[model samples]
Target: MQKAVGIIAEYNPFHKGHEYQIQQAKEQTGANIAIILMSGDFVQRGTPAIFAKHQRTAMALLGGADIVFELPSFYACGSAEYFSSGAVSVFNALNSIDFLCFGSESGEIDTCRFLGKLLADEPKLYKEKLRSFLKQGLSFPAARKSALAEYLKEKDIPFSEDFLDTPNNILGIEYCKSLAAQNSSIAPVTIKRIGSSYHETSLSSEYPSASAIRRELIAAWNTQKFLSDTLKNAQPPAVKDYLCALLENETFLIEDDFSLLLKYELMKNTPESLCAFSDMSPDLARRIYHHLNTFETFTQFAEQLKTKELTYTRICRALLHVLLNIPSDLPAISPAYVRLLGFKKESSSFLRILQKNSDIPIITKAADYKKLLPKEVHSLFEKDLFASNLYETVKCNKKSTAFTNDLQKPPIIL
Candidate 1:
């Protein structure tokens, strides 16, 4: 069996930095194949991906990933814990995956692993401290960080909360925790993120953040232009056209893209009914309902609803959940299938190995999904299908073209 390295990513635009990570993972693990578990049409920050999933998958294969699998919308649109666990579960189910490669600000795999164990175990002292912190009105992330820092201090353990503070590091920690919880054999490889913070909105010659690129691309589109020379130089050669088309055609989807539709959904349904969404608290639902008529866009509404307790992103995500009608009570189950988005031509043998050894079904064709998946699995899959359709509607509406339905989209083969 050949060693295979797995990467969990959004690839929101398949930038140069992502290509660098793929190359580094292959070299560091000495793996024969690189597998990417990517978010589908929707992404974790409560927004649609800049390019369609198929375009992103093609870019991944062109950038050297051997196989690309979809992280379904249910998990793709979730919080860090759920998103990481979902991707890790898919990797764990694969028979040949050996190492999980991820980027982190700390670039310390051992520290991530230790913290993962602590989180998975949740010692009594840690839990007590966590409750105490939450009672003080800190957000979940802040509360957890404080509790962990306090616990580490009392135990005289040498650790840094920097991992918890940085976005990629926090996700890396969740990946490790998921691995520990599942008692999986996959080893973790950490690559230190080079240049620019995750949220930095400025371009860097070496490695601009994804947020920065998206902002620049959108700005360029709004000005009826394409990427400038410097920005173009920073993109992978393969995705340049995709990026250009997305911007030129105005197909880019942001959290604010669904503003009108979300407002309609909120106005049409009772505030109490929205409590069935995962992120919507009763108070939060009422707040959104109260401001539904005042704000013209989801961004405006989210900002109006924001406070020290509610971050803008959190409010956006919650509104998305409500708009999509995500069940307040999603069943707790590992992802039930692997949906291939694309793959390199040379990776045929690896697919065979997965088909033979994977516990979950590998779905390559959308039409076959219904026949092959069980009732519960099919139900879960419907959410992803609905999300894709909604995303297509947004794209077509933007371009004023006929719908390019995803049901007819065959997996892209490079």
Candidate 2:
């Protein structure tokens, strides 16, 4: 029996740091294969990926993943809680994975587990503190941290709430919480993040942040510089070549590309109606409606709506829900099927093992989804198709290329 480690990621643009993580994961766990559950066209940050999912999948396979599966768009674009729950649920349902590995600022699994337990079982004092902080107008994240700090202080727990301040640690805690909530058997592991901070915008380090790489790519694209020059040391050789080839022929997408589509969605809805979308609140809906006349681009609108209570990423996510017509009430948090994106040819036997062990269907062909999935699950799968086609349409329109519907495309067999 071959051991496998499960990784949840957005590999927005596969870089050297990501390649290092995959290598380290396999070595640390002594696993025969590393399976990745990655975000599709849209990521958790409420924006489209800088590169399309298939392109990114190719990069992942080349970088060292044995198999890559798409995390459904609903969860991919959701908050940390939803994203972690969805990914952990899929891993649990698979029943063959041995470990769930993630990167965090603090590489202590026990601390993360303790915090996860505290959060999952929100004690009375913690709840009251949370509400009191919320009443004082702190953002949900800030309020939660403050409440946890006070509660832990009273309980005489020595752990610092400062761990929650880092993005990866926060997400790692959410993963722990989800694993505990589902009573999953998969063990959790962490690798300390290296080189750069999550939001750092500098490209000087060997393991530059993805945000920095994207910013550099955008700058180079605008100035007509080659990707090789811009990302010479930041990406793995294969990924760099793949990206260079992609940019030579296709248009790389950015948030502003969907500005017109978002504007159209906004034009058709009222403040009351807008509140029906995921992450949309009464206040946010009103603010969006009030500022409709001043809207320019998706990025601009999100920035315009940002406030002390609402962070910029949250605003972007809410606006994206409106643009994509995602309802506030989702049918299920757990994914119905595992959608294969790409895999190495040598891993065919491992793939079969996964299929044999998985409780749900493994979707390789888009056209066969209706036959393989339940009615509700089929409907959920349709959103992924719609999102891909919409992304293709925008990309094609921008590049003056003919529209090739991605629905007919099968999983990439590397």
lDDT of 2 by residue, 123-172 (tens): 99999999999999998999999999999999988867779899999999
Q: Which candidate number would show the highest TM-score if scored against the true structure?
A: 2
Query: lDDT score, residue 112, model 1?
Result: 90
Q: Global lDDT of each model?
A: 0.84, 0.89
Which residue runs does candidate 1 get wrong by more than 4 Å? 245-250
Worst 10 residues of 2 by lDDT: 326-335
For each candidate, what TM-score against the reference?
0.96, 0.98
Model 2: which residue pairs collide? none
Tens digits of lDDT, candidate 1, 1-414: 588999999987777888889889989999989999999988898878887898889878877889999997777878888888888888888767899999999889999999998898999999999999888988788999999999999999987777688999999989999999999999999999987788988886568788888898789878977578767766777667656665554567777778888888888877788888877878788887787779788778888998766777777778878777777566246778989999888898888888899989999998788988998778888888888889889888878978867778899898
